[model samples]
Target: MQWITIFKKEILEDWRNYKWIWVPLVFIVICIMDPISTYYLPQILESVGGMPEGTVLEPPEVVPSQAIMMSLTELSMLGVLVIVAISMSVIAGERKSGVAELILVKPVSYFTYISAKWAEKLLLVFTSYLIGMLASWYYVDLLFGQITAGQFFSLFFFYLIWLIFVISLTIFYNTIVKVPGLVLTLTVVTIMAMSAINQIFSYRMPWFPNSISGHITKMLMENSVPNALWGAVSITIILSVGLLIASNFILKTKEMAD
Candidate 1:
């Protein structure tokens, strides 16, 4: 209940401050861009004549579900950037603006404060992702055809997991770093580096969570359950909890370094 109050207050402030403008814009871009690419990418590619004079390029078959899912996942980089930006303000911004002192003067514990921020950010990210997914679904279906329930849900599940992982990484970065720019830069670099590392060593380190979401998405596209999905879920949970703990600890130990 207390955490909810904090979350509500922060959400209200977020709305008032329009701290969410980029989120929807990014989502809309992802939703629209995906279908456009799906519909035109093959033609665009084939227009570039690169073979024998008599050679012909076959148009790629467009599967509504697969195309939509691909678009959603492909634009995931935008989603990750938005998540990091939103969460960068979670703790670091408060400290910068002296809002942390005002909040701490209240009856809120550090845990409640951090928890509320995480909850609010998670809700915002999930809401944005859902909106993007639904819009992508409609556009793809309108252009192509109907998508199956299982396919829809499966793709949505994969998106949700990927979004959660992104949010967790952002929160972890926010908690550990004091500067927003540094936090955002470091987070992006770390995620990219970890992803590359995981890819290069995936055969030897199959349990690496960084690449787990991509593997899951691939499996979902093939309509098969990948064993790595569970590992991804577990790592996400662990990272989220660990970051929450670290944030609370930092808040408790550090004064408002204004």
Candidate 2:
């Protein structure tokens, strides 16, 4: 019951602060841009009006999978920053402002409080992903090619796991470091480093959780996912669970800086 109350409070914060509005709008725009740009490259180039006379422009055919890939890539690049910005203040802001101190003096357990925050943020991420996915599929089919249900679900679930891992990491980092700016910087740097290391050791450590993007690209290209993805998924799930538990523990020791 207390957890639910705290979760609702988190949701209310999202609503009042307009985080729910702008975040999903950004995602929807990214989704729409993916297919629109792919299908209209020739026209877009012509509109630039710098082409030599009689230059033939043959636009490349864009596939549905390609649009999906572009959408997911945009999310990976831009969405992480957006999500981190919104989540950076979850605990740090409260602690810094003495809100955590006031609230902690009540009957609230730190575990329930942190769990509620994590759960609510997870739900928000899932909602945004759904909207982005549906919008991408609708436009991709209209502008590029038909996306079958099988293609959509296979890649979506696989990509979703990676996204969940990222959100968990953001929260875990938020709890560990109270400075919002440092939290954002460290989280982005860590994820980028993980991706690079995963690539450098691709053949050697195919089962590592950071190889998620490679698997996502392969699935988007309509290829059979390598058996290594299963291993990565397992590792990612364990890590995400550990992050939440660690966050819960860390939150208990926080003293309000204000």
Query: Model 2: which ten-residue window has the lowest total lDDT?
Result: 249-258
Model 1 whole-model lDDT (C-alpha atoms):
0.73
Q: What TM-score does each of the candidates earn? A: 0.85, 0.94
For model 2, residues 68-166, the per-residue Cα lDDT tens digits are 788888888887777777788887777766787788888988888877898888888878887888899888888778888888888778878888888
**Model 1, 43-161: lDDT tens per residue?**
77667656567656664687775667666666557767777877886787777777777877888788887778888888887777777777787778887778766777777775576
TM-score leader: 2
Please give the CA lDDT of all the candidate structures.
0.73, 0.82
**Which stretches of candidate 1 lie above 4 Å from their native place?**
19-22, 41-58, 144-146
